[model samples]
Target: MELDEAFRFIGSKGPLKVGWYHILLYALLVFYNCWIIGFQLMGMIFIGHVPKNYQCTPPDGFFTNDTTPVLDETTELDKCHMYEVQDGIVTQNITECLYGWDYERIIGETSIVTDFNLVCGDAIYAKIAQSVFMVGVLAGSVTSGQISDFFGRKIVLHIALVLKAVSGVIMALLWDYNALVASWFFVGVFNQAIQISSYVMMTEMFPPEIRTISTPLVSLIWGLAVSSVVPIALLFPNWRHYQIFISVICLIGVPLWWLTPESARWLISRGQIEEAEEILKKMAKFNGIKIPNSFLSDDKEIPLNEDIIEPSNKGHDGENEGEVHQQYYLLRAVTK
Candidate 1:
């Protein structure tokens, strides 16, 4: 069988046949990918809550009811602070008080760096780490295309998951920033590829009528990911622990992997008709739906009669012979 045909058959095979199983498989993959968005939200939690606590200063005019002070230097530090709206919350942090400056002009960037002892080297190293991770993502994105096209999505996804799992362990164990960056880079590359390949596989397998909805529904996984990242981060606390959390999640994808059907389109395109037909039959049986008499008869035949007139298109007129021909061509193009 030709490569293109094989891919088409793989994608088109028995997508609707298994019904609930098919739904669940797609749901898990989509949800997993979307969950990455949650990781991004962790920055919000870090920025908002990672500061030290401080006592608030009282608003003016809280001294005693007396118009004038009872004693010249009797101004007790007012502990009864009243709430006052401010541009930003004035919170205590870890910065040591400067000799000349009262608050070290804490509103500005200089104060932040001075308070944190953050030098140019700190920023530089952070940038370098980020760049390494991004490079890994870019590399993985490129490699995934080749991997998915050549090896099939299921195998590629497994490979990506393994990389992700390893990266997580490496991140947890390594104390060196450079090593962490390197591991993260590989993780990014492989994880991203798996994500893309999974999405592509889902898009290919679903019926054309449901393609639009399925695509977005699958994308909802990203939204789910985003929503979950903060909670995941909170659960893990440390950044290294967060990596472990992500790794665990990736591991969960493994067993579900078996639930997925090989793409029927890909199978048909590859000329694995028997396998494709079997998958289709199983799908119908699992879904508790009956195959039409003609379809059943077609299945029973030893070798598919290439000349047999396929049944009429249902629910949609575009499924006429001409459109079916177009679909066949498109399927061929994808396999190639």
Candidate 2:
């Protein structure tokens, strides 16, 4: 009875069991690989982040608490308070640093200086840049999806990383907003490509039962990317400077490629059956199982001609008969 229960449990769980290390590695990959989703969310939030350029004053008598005198001139004579005054003129130049040019003029006389040639005074430039980026993403998602499927996922993802690095550098160092606009557009496009590849990679590597659970768990890393950006934005306070910071962090993730394994599905699909079997064997070993010697052979392909053939009668019947005979014989022998 005990042996029967043990056999039943093993049959139900299949031949595979994912261990702690496999789960941890997969979770980490999903986190970093799915970072672009968070960026997409941030980009949507950027719709709010960008506008409200209109300058406004705090209100009337806003600086009423200020009692500091502009000047206090005195001479060392007659109690040295206001005894003697030297013939000197006091003048100061204070223009809008806080309220920008428009609101500054309302408070006092000021001239409109075109200090920021970036993105021009036209907010539409940024709006258009953002729009183009999203469009690039829309198109690249389809294109890269095909590419990753046809080629390997790693190659497709690597290509996107290269594009991202090149575009990021050009955008950060160059003077032309047009170039910045174009580069950022490509950034969105390449980012989508990277994401699609990551998803494909994760899906291929995980087992079917836990596949759905694992894929989204890896995706949770997107939140960290969003949360970290806020501090970088505040600290840098300049757009190009912030872009440089982002570019460097992006470059760091590129080297993490060394840590990951090629997709076992891709290997099998390309007819690299031996390699796929090897990987599966390794996975089994990691899960603390000794894979059968039969599994190690190159005869890994199990042909399925659904229309012409049915399940193997011999193999099925033999398994059932063997188990039943073993149980019956053991009972009879024990009783005798």
Task: Tell me the TM-score of each prediction against the true structure.
Answer: 0.60, 0.60
How many clashing residue pairs appear in each of the predictions shown?
Answer: 36, 1
For model 1, what is the alpha-carbon lDDT of residue 183? 74
Q: Write the per-residue lDDT of candidate 2 for residues 116-230, one digit (tens) a residue.
A: 2212245456557667778888878879988877888777877776777667667667666677667777877787887788778777665566576766665456667778666
lDDT of 1 at 277: 59
Write down the lDDT of every candidate, Cα atoms only. Answer: 0.51, 0.50
Worst 10 residues of 2 by lDDT: 76-85
Model 1 lDDT-worst window of ten: 94-103
lDDT of 1 by residue, 153-272 (tens): 777877677777777677667766567667767767876777777777777656565576778765555665666665665665555556666676677657866666666555565666
- In model 2, the runs with Cα more than 4 Å from the true position are 1-16, 36-121, 218-225, 281-289, 292-336
- Candidate 2 local distance difference test against the native: 0.50
